[model samples]
Target: MRFLLVEDNAELGDAVVAWLSMEGHAVDHALTLAEAHDWLAVAEYDLMLLDVMLPDGDGRSFLRETRTAERLPVIVLTARSQVADRVDTLDLGADDYLTKPFDFAELEARCRAVLRRRGTPAPVVIPLGSALFDPSSGTLTQDGESQRLRNRELRLLEVFARNKGQILSKSHLLDRLFSQDAEVTENAIEVYVGRLRRRLQQAGVQIETVRGVGYRMTAP
Candidate 1:
């Protein structure tokens, strides 16, 4: 999923970005509220990891201003862990809250939980034509036979299923599958698409490519 991280401290921001990237999330880092607003204006993000303190303005004010229209899930990260602070952020429509010096694993888990809560509950077996994709086990089955997919393949399929019928560009797919540090080329995306297409075809599932644009996975 795409995440916007709003933080002011350079060192802390870099560390959080690196950690989230390693966890296979597409993260955009913003050091100030102005920068965060700029990103929110142009891009779509699944969640916002907001730091309450900023150089020019407080993140709480920013949340209050954009909360109505954006309606995007937000997780407030702040050093002020007082009860009042928590109450204030929650009142401002934050979906979750995390204190500073938090564990990265816990943060990742919270992000996943928030996103899951925002999305429809995935079925145990997703049926597409004669094939069934098992979300729980990340396995694809056809005619009672099952095939295990690599982590990246499973993730790609999950993204496709989650946003079924949407044309996702190659760059967006790469951002979803690999971290910023992972070396990815246009050809790399093509290679993975080829492999995924062959596997799905073997299972009698159809994934359509929008020539020169991207790909879409249709539901049965």
Candidate 2:
């Protein structure tokens, strides 16, 4: 999962980022509201950990501005513990709230809870025939054995696994396989698909190419 951490406290921000990354997540940190907004403009994120205080503006204000348009889940990280503060943050659009001096374990749990509420949390392990795909760490195992995958291959497989049994257009696959800034051709998508099909076949999952359409995952 990808998360954006908007925090001004260097120690706390570094700890949180390190913890989440160790647990197999991609994280971006911003020290100010403006920097956070800049990151949000170009990349996709699953959840955001926002701090209430910033150098340029209040995080609450930023939340209010984005509440109507943003779809990613948000958890407010602040030192305020008053009932009214929590209530107001929730009312403004925070999916959850965390006070300062929090344990990393609890923070991870809250992150999962918010994602679950949005119905976007990935399973710990995806079982396909005799294969197992752990989306968190992007690990694949087959018949009690683990399979090594390149970064791109793992990402491509994740996209296919999440939308299993559905036809994914070439354009859609291309977009999902690469970041917004990546420039990959449509034909390049075919090469990745072909590689995935051969390797996954060993684990009993077939990625079938639909005639002149796209690709679908099915049991062999």
Candidate 3:
């Protein structure tokens, strides 16, 4: 999953980004509404973590305007713990609200809940031939055995499994796989794809390279 985290606090923003990224989700952190707008203009994000008090403007107003423009799922992260504030934000179309100084684990749960409610929720476990791939934990199970995959490999597997049989361009895969790393090259993706292909081959899955265009995944 890809997330656009809109917050201004350096400490909090850094912590959230690190936490989400470690969980195998691609995250782009925007420190202000202007930066958020720029990110929104360029990339399609699965969720937005918006801070109510930004350096540039009120996040509530931004949420209102954003609702009019797109169907992006937003979870407001704010210090305002008032019941009225929560109700008002919900009325404005926020999918969820998290007050400041909250638990990171809780935030992660809320994010998953909001995504499941707002978007096409992925299966809890996707069957790939003889294996079962769990998106939530990035684990692949086969023959009643399961093992958690490395972060990048898990992300690549999830992306491929979600869009099975569709040809994904290198540029598109690059954006999804290496959103936070500007230094990663297309060659890096090839390495990851090669590794994932080897793993999936045992499960009766194939990752096909489309010559000059991109790659496609098919499961038997």
Candidate 4:
């Protein structure tokens, strides 16, 4: 997932960005409303984490102005806990609101829920023979049992499952598995693919090497 975090507080901004990155998300952060707008103009984001207060402008005004202009999902971060404030923000098109001093875990959960609502209509539970893959939770189950996987391996598996039977090159896998700024080598992909192939054997899934090409996934 790609996210835009618009927060003036450096500490909070850094914390959120780090947490999201650890969860396999690409985050672009801005400290002001103008900077946030610039990001929105150039690149599309899966989600936006906007603050109610900005040095240059009110975040609510920004939300109101661009709500109809784009289909981006937004979750408002504000200290305002009053019913009127919440109602007004919601009316102005905020998808979810989090007050100050909120739990980081709760924030993560809300962000995920908002994304689930805005994300593609594709099914979360993908079946591979007797295996069940939930991209949302990053879990795989085989024959009613859960299997452990490294985060990168799980993400790589999801890419293959989404594009099952299509040859996926090392470069394409690297792009999908890591953020634009992530330092990862093409050789790293080979390791993950190999690990996944061995682990997936019992699930009746196969990751076939395409000679000089790449890899493909099959469930039979």
lDDT, candidate 4, residue 197? 80
The TM-score-based order of candidates, best leading, equals 3, 1, 4, 2
- The candidate that achieves the highest lDDT relative to the unseen native structure: 3
Q: Give the Cα lDDT of each candidate.
A: 0.81, 0.83, 0.89, 0.84
Question: Which regions of candidate 3 deviate over 4 angstroms?
Answer: none
Model 4 bad stretches (over 4 Å): 119-124, 143-145, 166-177, 185-191, 202-204, 207-216
**How do the residues 89-199 of candidate 3 rate in per-residue lDDT, one tens digit apiece?**
999999999999989999989998998898657557898888999987878988888888888889888888888999998888878866654678889889999998777
Task: Write down the TM-score for model 1.
Answer: 0.79
Worst 10 residues of 4 by lDDT: 174-183
Candidate 2 lDDT score at position 8: 97
Model 2 whole-model lDDT (C-alpha atoms): 0.83
Report the C-alpha lDDT of model 2 over 1-220, residue by residue, as the tens digit: 6788999999999899888766645678898999898989977888899999899999999999878787779999999999999999999999999999899999999998899899985567887767888876667888677877766677678878888899999977765554343455888888888888877778889988898899999864
Clashes of each: 0, 0, 0, 0
Q: For model 3, give the 10-residue run with minimal summed lDDT.
A: 174-183
Question: How high is the lDDT of residue 104 in model 4?
Answer: 77
